[model samples]
Target: MQHLDDATRTELEAAAFRRLLHHLDEHKEVQNIDLMILADFCRNCLSKWLVAAADERGADLDYDAAREYVYGMPYAEWKAKYQQDATPEQTAAFEARQAEKREQKDA
Candidate 1:
């Protein structure tokens, strides 16, 4: 296996992260609720992670700024453009899955 230098590894990681953001932007039909229920993470999760990463580097990042980085725009603008009101059934299923996850974690 070829060894990557630190700079090369960092560049690759950054590129991969950018690709993920682009993928999420292109697939805006995938709702946060579905992501939470299935993957336990979503765009909001990505935003929070960005904030945490900034904090680790001693940079204070507000939620809106982090969200902009994750969503490729202001969160409200992204919502207005792509977010839909999840159906009641979808909400219920999400809650059920969350509850099940909590129970499993507690066991």
Candidate 2:
């Protein structure tokens, strides 16, 4: 908000992001493919963004650590516990989404 100081705004954003990670943790049934189709981003996307942000701030963070922070556990363990194979319909939707993104980028 324009009215808020920089430190306050950053604090609020960080808190909201933490809540979002918690929310995603609570909804493990929502697969990454569904997220990519609907929202163009997923938990893995968040992990990558975290790494980019850390790099910006000169911090040492790796993809695996960022993923663990987002996932509430190690990536492989989370995959074993909750990740599902994409259904045929989901795969089709994902392909369509990718094509649309490519078209937009080319345009």
Name the best candidate (by lDDT).
Answer: 2
In model 1, residue pairs whose N, Cα or C atoms come closer than 3 Å (at least 3 residues apart or on different chains), thus clashing, are none
The 10-residue segment of model 1 with minimum total lDDT is 1-10
The models' CA-based lDDT, in order, is 0.90, 0.98
Q: Whole-model lDDT for model 1 versus the true structure? A: 0.90
- lDDT string for model 2 (1-107, tens) is 99999999999999999999999999999999999999999999999999999999999999999999999999999999999999999999999999999999999
| Residues 61-81 of candidate 1: C-alpha lDDT, one tens digit per residue | 988998998889999999999
- TM-score between model 2 and native: 0.98
Query: What residue pairs clash in candidate 2, if any at all?
Result: none
Number of clashes recorded per candidate: 0, 0
Per-model TM against the reference: 0.88, 0.98
Stretches of candidate 2 off by over 4 Å are: none
